[model samples]
Target: MVAVRLSADSNGVLETPRDGDRMSAISRRALLTTTAGAAAGLAVAGCGAAGGGKQGAPRAQRTGEHSGASGARAPAKTVRLIGDGSTADTGPQPNQPVVDRLEPGQTPPQFVVFSWDGAGEVGNGLFPRFRKLADDHGATMTFNLSGLYLLPEDKKLMYAPPNGPLGASDIGYLSDEHIRMTLDNLRQAWTAGHEIATHFNGHFCAGSGSVSRWTPADWKSEIDQAVAFVTQWKTNTGWYDEEPLPFDYAKNLIGSRTPCLLGQDNLLPTAAAIGWRYDTSNPGGDQIWPSKRMGVWDYPLQLIPFPGHSFEVLSMDYNMLANQSHAATSSDPRNYPGWRSQATASYIAGFQRAYETNRAPFFIGNHFEEWNGGIYMDAVEETLKHIAAQGYKDVRMVSFQQLTDWLDAQDPALLDKLRTLEVGEQPPGGWKEFLGQVPASTATGGAGEGAAPAVTATT
Candidate 1:
């Protein structure tokens, strides 16, 4: 039987499982303390100040992945310093002024809104419009395409027949025609610069119930197959060179939102072992929390509990919106136009509140197939526009893997700042703290256009 465990800390409630389980809980406080100690140690070592006399000036270079289209290498000037005088290392070089400053208790930098449940009965014929909406909002969404949708000929055969190794009914079965259409649609989206990741070949229910039931090898094959299919499609469509298939260019089929968000505890650790860096399956509902596992990040879909049945309420709204949009006419007042106006208003209001309060990256989660077509489409576009107007600049629309890469590339200084704050420290009851700190600007040597002086301190 699958076991689950929930724990609370300064960030929010975190659900993980027992040892040896797929998911693990991390204490924000513990993480901060650990990070702080490490930073302090590094600072002392770098300066050679711990032993007595000063050492040769430590190297000025910082290391991490660059944020660019070609994955080309670029120098990062800002580095995270730890210890008593870490901040002293940073100062305004000759001509430059610090434009942005981060104080203690600030929320972490950047917010992301990710969508799941793309492909299959719900997502078929709906993605084109959805893609448009995502584009309009300047938001990056991950379409966790179900693998069953990739098989065209014997679509039903993709699902494990009853009495097969995976006992329960297949949750994401789709018609062969629908599968091919969805594949084509996804290719279009990818070419247009959207992220397409995996939701799993069998969905969440596929590997639920017991670990003994599914081996590591089974899990690997399931994930590998999805990666292989997408990679092959890119090649077939001439997206990559035909002669020497760009295996390196293969998208890091890394993001996953479990079917039903059910088997997250089981899926997370398994994913990590197989090289995934992020999972968006947990349903914390509006609150953002870092994952316990260090390498992977958890972008939980925020769901707020209401007086009435919450899921039922959301489901009803989804269906209503879907139907209204699907049947909407250009002139219908209570149809597409009405839903767009209302949803946009709500999304803007919510986003503003989150931004002002420094609790952002607002997540609006829904199955691709659940809504009335026109209404859903309209809501998506309006929401996108509203967000853009709200001054959310440089929003990175990326896949789950890209998110992880971004996180991995975080300026050690940013992480150091979070570490110094002491993970679980909360501001006074009435005060709102901004935890999102922007990285220090990189330094360009030899005085080029917009170049600043190079200042290095030895203490």
Candidate 2:
């Protein structure tokens, strides 16, 4: 029940002013407010903050089974438990794509981050379905797990969210069966190299004492609750038969998407204090290289081409839904085809805008929902296929964590240069001259210059 702020048109997309002016969804004043249910922070939700805070990406270690290019199977890594035997370090993240720094003359790859809010595997099957989709495409994504999704309704009292009464949540706990399903999916996701991030617990929005009202102390409470739920799932669920998650939540969790994209001003500090690496709660930002806010990466939702509209919408399904159907989660049957097309086109246009111009990492957000006849889901799958299509070299469907690793490895000056390009603007004098480096032998033409090979960094 996070306030679907601005009552979206199709489902979760906010109803923007008819004039189509962008950037009005969230206000600066709202973010500065210590008030309880208003909106704040406008990069559009990420998946962020400033300063060179102490957080760094965990060093890579070998994990699971792997095969050499020569086709010989590598020995499996031993699983080492971290804490309470709830999570284990099996080694380099299995199936995690190689992430390396961009060379002096390399053009940044078109990194598209496909992330979800309240990620859970339920009867809908969308979770497993997309997991297969990612594997099919050799892509990775971030799953913003809503903590309560791992908590059964019977264990609701265990949550105790910030500011609200005990066990109080706008969106209540899931069924025990669903919780187990969520657990299964979460474990599989990590093993497959997908990132597990947060959407916090209790999902407060305006009128329900939304998180927007909470202070850093309030946010810490929320963060602690979220962490406890993931790390203590075995203890909470008491499902001894089930194996624990494959990674340490305390070590693994580094990013989040605040509910409704609210309360980031406070959330950033809380994130930094806990050594988190990023926050994705900004409401609206352009296609540009991300920088640190509050000392961590602020990977906010971007404002991208909205196809027919003059104002670009946040790259999120809810915004698309609002623009098409005015907050109607279920639309007229007749509108399905057009809505799907519009949604698909928006995603492609947004991707192309960055692909052609700035090469800023695209942060696309979605929920595991069956809204608007499931048109958004169809649109995302189609868009991903298009991104991975032939001739699209250097394109990756990455998780926010993977994207951050790659970004952190780059030179600050090079990223600053990237931020100079406008929408659809190509580099002047081409890639080699612009970046002052030579292309690899395997890479053909100008595109090869920025396509650096992947690297592994071990602690």
Candidate 3:
């Protein structure tokens, strides 16, 4: 079992008593009462450190290889469909990095997972724009696709979101042309070796019957609808000229981020039963190595050092916009430059926070919208360019699935030992003495991970 180290409040102030094991810069809501209390509270499964999964449900399968620094995918020999020809098994994925085990005496890779919500191609061309950006940086991101993006606006009434009126959504249905564009981008993204995860159907973030109050059963229905919409988009939209998405979404899909990052407690059981490998729906987490929740990987948006703020903020564009511009508007162009700098710096700071310390995987969430005259988009792009640059070659910008594979292949106890390193605290006695004794063979059992060149952290 991993020992508990330190617990800090939102402002990075340590308040919880420490036994020198695991530490967290978690928000008040995710903070623990004590050492054991925190471990007990955080670990919801009964499977000890390895964590547990659903009853009788099989574990999620690892499909892609960790292609190392090159991020190459195995070419598919032939294309074939599983059921209705909605998706095909196109040969090798073009840009995936094989998930490999860390070697002995190696420092952990400073992993940064860049993901998008409602990952669809709009008329603004952000989808293709970012896809190229990711490819250029050797980054493979998780695209949490909206189900209704495949269903045309004319077919809006087909959706049945829980508790809401039939065919309703906080984020409305997509137009037929937009759906086609979304499909085009999705196909291209899959070919480029990025992950296509779900964002659920009919994103009802709040009000009665929203995700905040959804149950396991409710989530199942939503998930089913989301899948059905994608696999049956041909029937839904009657567009036969386009080539089908080049992967069985049911098999390809192994994880998701919920609408607004709410209702994860109820979502996990459903996800586990369906053999999903991980969930990025967590609302508040730190830049520490992630632990499994309900036997599935819990990769959450971390709370990072927000410059000029008393408390840290979620490492997501939405939260940053909420803090910088309360109404999510950009009417005053005067604040654009400063706001852009702050947003960009926030992401860089979040990466540095983990990179310099625990080397926990940094997860940055974004959207396709050009919020604040697209300053947030610019901010994220700038951060990506720097982090994936030659100077920071050790930074591995991977998808959640690639990361989970690496994590699962690891010896759990070793992960617990890594957990003992507090945020920004190096190995107690350096790498040699700290990881002196290697454990028995597991999946590619190795002694260490790696890190990148340090980026300046802005407050």
Candidate 4:
């Protein structure tokens, strides 16, 4: 048994355990109402809170404790909420949609390429090739830049920090000079109309089990810092030539791919509060705007699991390619031929599957290190040529931010319809489904059985 206490300081909701009890903190805003029943030997706590706002002051703070028949109390788990109010039995009502109308045909879904787990070397190595490929195909792409790249020192810090909440084994090799070069490359991409967006400053896991560990405040801080950092960079660069860069596209500069492809089901409210419209973290089907979370659309990548494999190969190839050892393999130009041909073949098959089906948006993700070898670069170039050969009518390659802006500007009714269109259990048929299931582990790895998938080596 657990005793839970709820209190709201000016900062937010805080929860602490009483004598002998256990509790868990929830992310939504709702007043927790405790219903105690002695006869049933059960105490059900209900949370009833309305939308965010100040309520009447509490008459008295309520506290409860539970013990066994022998009068022996169990250890308690502490949970907290950040608001002022009494605990209630009701949960929060879903946000009402402003427009609830439907259109006839589904909007043609867009293909977006997303990479995960930052590797500055990989980013630096691959961007040129990727840029050329995009140019050849006349398509734009979105790179969910890992927060690891933004670390004050090492570039890998952009993916997961060295000592913070999400850090594990740090493998950053990019120095300040390298980072500046990488940033310059990003600026070039931005100038060329590519999308640069956040992949979580700390690569925070977003699935159900792991997500419960994040407090609302924690979410706010992580996202806020990421947005602030990117905004600051753009602002600084805009003034580089003694002229203000146009701010017309600043707001559209929002897109994210959670580390390890963990879904953001639990972080919707926090994301909404921060004004993000699309997250490419999870892959499943054709593009979908989920009904439960308003305004956000999910575009999943599609690919099939490689032969004799439990998982797909894209992320694995990404990780392997990013590791320096793989770069050494590419030093020999002769060996590049086979690997390049294989990689290009794989990517072409994936892209063609999506394109032939009219899924205009296809996310082809890879880590920066994947392009270290000249062979890998050649493969990437070949893949681009293959995509171009498909003859996409208006292959408007776009960044995640651009997609969000377009969605935001649509009629509210259209937006609602997009959100309500269910893609069934998984994302639409294509590479989106193939790429959506990247593995993520919990903090303790396997510490908690019901816990969400934490960071782990999936491939």
Candidate 5:
């Protein structure tokens, strides 16, 4: 178990109530309270520390040794640098699953997305720990990188957050050493087939300067800055020794998860206008099939069954901690054993319900935190292994970008039919009969003369 340093709030207040100061910057609403009955209150999953520590010297260049998106190594090719050589064009991404349209009556693959927030590596080893885990299981996940993590704290004024003064930030900036480590992890993550999406910057979640109040124009500004920090790190930092990132950020970033799960209502328009493919910022969503908002796929944090409780909890590590110990990052030692088991069970139960019934994709969000003695991290590791044991043929662990590719390639009618199945509700009759009625022309890659059939299933 690792311990993370708590970042000061936007106002520079450091409230250290526990060993790690877990919620030092968490908003009031983020202090979620769940009860014993079926009336548990929903709380937002707050972002964790952006702390960094010594992790070893980062590799100076990309070897391109990792396999491609389809699990096959791409042919050796020269890398063409972009901009000031902060990033490069590395052909197709590696470790990506080949997206194919599901044949009629075929069982849809159970998709599980394990995503990380504030994807910073602060010497705690959480970042590389999970990357190794994914490698062991042949799984790929998304790392929602915060742009501020790359910007040196000394260059804080470079960022002009909307509704706030110059150099203002809620989450602390990583040290130069940590920043180098972050760059290294990002480079390796991309080449290993994991997505490097945005988690925005500043992490402002409270007061007038909070992201929740930001307008679409404000969101556009924030997104632009986030991209700049990533694509032009060389120009900003003046560091020429390190290698550029493997992929082009401008084209690679197709999705994001807003800070504190706030401002999505306004962020959606800017996301769609910018041609983003998906958004996972919505809160307290049911365990049902996802729909689109502003023409972009909406993959929200779902309400999964909370073990030993009447109500459910959000499919996130922070939410589990909130319910278990009232948001305390460190709690009574006696409760650790039971809490770990409960958290593990919660994730597994959620996955089983969807995999056995509706086949809805499972989205789990976490931070590189050691909250509650790092039990949440342990639970997440266990959950990943549990699902991986189900065999890769049917249970495919993927990134949000990979999942979106599959979704876009599918038959819309078939997807609509799948959406009809509610949480824990199986397909009417069976898989063979329920999907057998979909017309062939509407099937993926099918181009026939027959018209697509209307939805006859109960909504």
Candidate 6:
């Protein structure tokens, strides 16, 4: 969940609008607060994130299992366990598409990333539900797992968040059973070709200890702790009988979305220092092509079309709920149907705006919760199915890491040209004419240039 500071005018209209006024007039129904109950409920209910697979494309065989071109079977996977045997170094991830540079005249794929926050199970079956949904639609996604979710409640004080109480976290720690479930899902998600990123731990979104005020050092400490929790879960839980997570998280973690979208400004410096590829913590970004921030990709939650409203909302489920039901988790049930439809339309509108025009990547953030009779979840499902029905080979539903792979493969000049496209604006004379002439000499640091970096299936 990204953090936002929205204020309405006397007429109750959102301020400082942009993207052709799409960001204007969002109803001032409620102040999107980061209350302890809301944060803890999101974590206790299901404190983790999710990933998906791309539709219409054949899943790639795991690297080390076959020759890339000849299709010849290769050697078996070699798994080397890491610290405390909580994680391992498996070969390339399975089902990863072979990323290549876009040829001249080739239109870029419509990349849609559906990420979950606080991705925990908690007996709700949402983790598996979305996993199955991704498989069914051939989409790949990013699951932002909260480190605290894996830390046993008994060991809660083990966490030391900056400026916050030692071992204190706004989000609740998971039960032992739920921790095991989260681990199981994470292992499966990794093997099945989804990206597992971090959501940090102890969501502190307000007051003096809020992540919004954390410094670079504080951010680094948080990141290090998050990594330790993920890599040392075995020590924390003493559940040696459980299977180790299938990938080396230290290497696999190339990106993250901060809790409640806080602390990104400080987090980016640490993220770049630690060699992370991207951060998706910025809120209220327009639906335009992304660019690097502090040398890392900045994939912000965008302002998208909101049905029945003159303004736009952040492309997130909770933001929608904030505008629709004023942040009340359980609103009037009779209004659920209309609210659900509005949410679905809003998502679809956001997708269509990007798909039909600038072709910027569409990102949607979610948490596994039954907010407002679970309409948001239903709306997300409907939106994914609708997108899948398009059946366009160029409409790629990929994870953040996978998208990074593609971005790194492109000519920087071509990317610059792509960035010129404003929200809902099309290429001057269509994609072929627009991107076909990007000078080969201008590739600069792009992978399409000489001596492309050695890319593996894992990243």
Name the TM-score of candidate 6.
0.85
**Which model scores highest in TM-score?**
6
Compared with the true structure, all predictions reach lDDT values of 0.39, 0.66, 0.65, 0.38, 0.72, 0.72
lDDT of 5 by residue, 1-459 (tens): 111112333311122123222234432112211111111233335443431101121222322222232111335676778889888897776556667777678888899999987787776777777877887777788888889888888899999999999988777677777777788778767767788999888877656777778999999999999999999888878887667887989988999988767788999999988889789887657777777877788898887888777667778887777667866666898999999999999999999999999889999988877767889889999999999787757887889987887777778777777788899999988888888887654343111112122322210
Q: What does candidate 6's lDDT look like per residue over 200-230, in tens digits? A: 8877665677777899999999989989999
lDDT of 2 by residue, 204-264 (tens): 6654466777899999988888888887777777865556676878788989998767788
lDDT of 1: 0.39
- State in Å the error of residue 85, model 3: 2.0
| Candidate rank order under TM-score | 6, 5, 2, 3, 1, 4
By TM-score, how accurate is candidate 3? 0.79
Better of 1 and 3 by lDDT: 3
Q: Write the per-residue lDDT of candidate 4 for residues 113-175, one digit (tens) a residue.
A: 433224232223355556545654555556655443434443233333322544332222234
**Stretches > 4 Å off in candidate 3:** 1-77, 441-459
lDDT over C-alpha atoms for residue 132 of model 5 = 75
Model 1, stretches more than 4 Å misplaced?
1-110, 120-125, 153-176, 204-218, 228-251, 292-294, 304-346, 370-377, 394-399, 412-459
Off by over 4 Å in 5: 1-44, 48-76, 440-459
Q: How accurate is candidate 4 locally (lDDT)?
A: 0.38
Candidate 3 lDDT, 1-459, residue by residue in tens: 111113545454222122232322211111100112232112110000000011121111111111121112334256676456677766555555555555455677888888877776556667777777776656778788888778877888898899888888656655666676677677666766678889887665435765768899999999999999989888777765456777889777889888656678999999888888789877667677787777777887777877776667667765566566642334488899998898888899888878877788998887766656888789889998878664776688888866776776666556766777765677766766665554644433222332111222211
Candidate 1, run of 10 with poorest lDDT: 44-53
Model 6 worst lDDT window (10 residues) = 22-31
Q: Report how far off residue 52 is in candidate 6 (Å).
A: 4.1
Give model 2's TM-score versus the native structure: 0.80
